[model samples]
Target: MSNQEKFVVSRIIPAPSHIECVSGGMFKLADGCPITVISPLAEAELSATLHDTCNVYWKATPSFSFQAGGEGIAADGYRLRVTAEHCEITASGLSGIRNAFKTMRQLAESERGVLKSTCWLLPPVAVEDEPALAFRGIHLCWFPETPTWEIEKNIRLAAYYKFNYAVIESWGMIRLESHPEYCWDEFAVDKKEVSRLVKLAASLGLTLIPQLNLFGHATSSRCGSGKQMLLDRHPEYASLFEPDGWTWCIANPCARQYLTELVTELHDLFDKPPFFHIGCDEAYNAGSCSLCRENYPAKLKAHLMYFYSLFAKRGARVMMWHDMLLNRDDPRWEGYTAYGHSSRGLDELYKELPKDIIICDWQYGYPEKDGKEPDWRTSHFFKQTGFDVLVCPWLERRGIKSLGCLAKQEKLFGILETTWHWYRGSFRKETLFVIASNAAWHPDWTPESNVVYREYLNRHLREMDQDMKSKKYIQFGSVQYQINPAPYQD
Candidate 1:
């Protein structure tokens, strides 16, 4: 056996470190060996996955023994050691223990036919592991009538790999009681569905953050995810400018009031995690309204602060898409939707907006670096401009080594892997999710070989696919055709 073969080999996602094969012989389980748990969260987790994970169903002798003495464990770290008599796991935190069970469940896979048979063997080894980044997450863009089972499947896959958070970029999914006219019935899901999703995610230790599209991105036509019903019903709410500025009239108090009510409704409904993502990207028609027309620059700044304050007052940590305030010095910014226009001044947005609000910097393409669109200097500028930056990427496929590199820098909260097109389903995303999940968990990982990474990702995905098949999930995604709008502006 090779020197590396001495360590226990794990097909577990987000691979662990400091692995060692203490015994060459396979460790067999004795009947009714107790699992010692130092955390209550671990207990609940073990109960949830115990049945489905392992083929053998040996009932534990005792429930739990809570005491803490895990010295080297990170925030969400674990230490596991398996031997002949008993297998034990120790972690400093509840999440760590939950994670340890996931690996153990994989390790306990047995080829033995009987449930009571203790023939399954994971080599006796001691392993110590923890995540590199505090925030490891994936982003899902929502379309009209997203199935509840579909949502559950996505969340289940993320949790299985130990990914911590999921951001659903859906302004049209859930029905808001205050504005029934704003969302179409086909697109709007029931409150009960949302509740079920919340509970399901919490059970898996994953936090679901709903992105509320507030200011801008509103139109009565095709080619946009903006809330158009509000504008169709109330044309006065439309922005002041021309050239089809698909944005709300930020100058209008009624528009602001309308969004405020919506925000309040969302706050009262879920109210867990206390974080809100206010979609303020691509507001090309900033000063388009009558009230906001005069002193456009000042009004833009005021509106920025005003919208930000609405959430800040509710004691919710605010998050916003940073394209509107993009500071790319490169010429490639022209093609970008958020570039130069007859709109509000973005030159001073980073300076004017509050420092606490997280800047979700999403760069879909423009792969050039150095002096390119958002090079090192540009990223440093955002950091210096007093913002907690999150490196967002349209990671439909392929690992984002650039974002991973940026994540190592200061002032960066973490990385956000965005799947912009709802139609573009799990095919590419499954592969990307594995890479993003690994990148987030292990910040110091070297992207030495794509072949190795693909193999590692495939192994974890194969196991997940089996789970999905067993659960009888309809394994398919349809392509949603884009609407071709009339050439005329609304």
Candidate 2:
């Protein structure tokens, strides 16, 4: 056989056109690395998986060579060898890429090609595939009200895509204020809900970071509950600021005490190691409080420093949102979780924060915008700052073409895809998982490019059925909403 021609299955089976379109087939390399092979057979399996998984449109065609590592293989349980050379992985169809991904998991971490319930694969596949940033995480819908099994399902899905971090926001388990089951006390019967997920994430090598809205966001606070409503009654507790006819008073002593207690209470809820996300965003209405206004900048700094110190004392690190600096008035303020925002907002804060703080730059690009969508400038800036960075993409956003295959090949630090309960029907977990596995090997890929995606699909189908060819036109739609209030709705 030629150097390029290692092996090919002689017996081929036929699959549906759609199946042949999205996937080709996967190959177990000599080094045990899973490589994608494009052909008719692979596509059949891909269509089968997608038909069994989601309602999305996909098209795959063409034969392409994509692999993610040096030639690797395993002879038995006792003998394993992988070359130190960089790995190369390629696939045409989206499904083809996904099957290859599963194969990788089986090769890298699993024995007997069987994966435990909660399992995934990280890096070191290729020497050059190092993340540009250290900290990467999902920022929304982290705290879901769904059954524990579903939440755990989502967790595994996230890990399978090779994402290492996720934010458990305050939306799940506890209903927001005034919605319905609003318990006046900060009690939690579902506190144990996170136990299984926490253990599962740990086992999968993913971090589950807890996030709670600390000052502001009284949407959960009511008129009767004195603590939940903040110190609006005291007026002394609000922040001091005037932006477009509004001033938030952060000087209020009552507010400080309230936040302190809230943080302490949340800390006790988790059974795992203590890393917390203190949401300090949208404090525009703060600082105007009596005591906060007196020392404004100094006090704001003090407040953040004090809180961070508290968490540090407990052997935990605190992450705060970096939006407050956009005020233009609070230029001196620098403490936050990470410099996170869309690609458009990155350059504005590049020079402001400490180098130690990481940045999470996000973008949800589609075919209309170009398949290889992402703000490359942000990546360059993050590299320049010597700070860590991660990419957060909205895979299911409306009006955006889903380019699962293309995104996986990008040079990004890590991929963070979201699944909000409110927008649950957007994309299937299957689609997200396939794309995420693509990201694990290639972080800086652009979705607008179809060359790689098409190749991946072809390979996947070829593996499942040999008597299939390129096909097109699989349609799926996703609906997304802006958080802004509508004129006709509440």
Model 1, which residues run further than 4 Å from truth? 1-10, 27-31, 38-66, 106-108, 112-121, 219-245, 327-343, 369-375, 396-399, 422-427, 446-473, 476-490
So what's the TM-score on candidate 1?
0.79
* Candidate 2 residue lDDT tens string, 1-490: 2221111110000100111111122222223333234332354555454332211112222133333332222110011112332223334334334433433333332124565422222223221122222333454454323443345545654544445676776542543322223222233235455565676675454678776655434433322333332233333333422221132233555545655665565565554355677665544345444444454555556666667677777777665544543433333222212222322233244364445443444444432335444334433445466754444455643211122222233433444554444433323432344344344433333343222333333343322222122132221112123343577595
Off by over 4 Å in 2: 1-136, 140-147, 172-189, 215-250, 264-274, 327-355, 361-387, 395-423, 426-437, 444-490
Q: TM-score of every model?
A: 0.79, 0.49
Q: Name the 10 consecutive residues with the lowest summed lDDT in model 2.
A: 9-18
Best by TM-score: 1
Query: Listing every candidate in turn, what is its Cα RMSD in Å to the true structure after a full C-alpha superposition?
Result: 6.0, 13.9
Clashes of 1: 5
Q: How well is each residue in 47-152 modelled by candidate 1, as lDDT tens digits? A: 5454433332223232334454675678778988877655677887667876886776555545466767544555677878887667777777656545555566
Cα lDDT of model 1 overall?
0.62
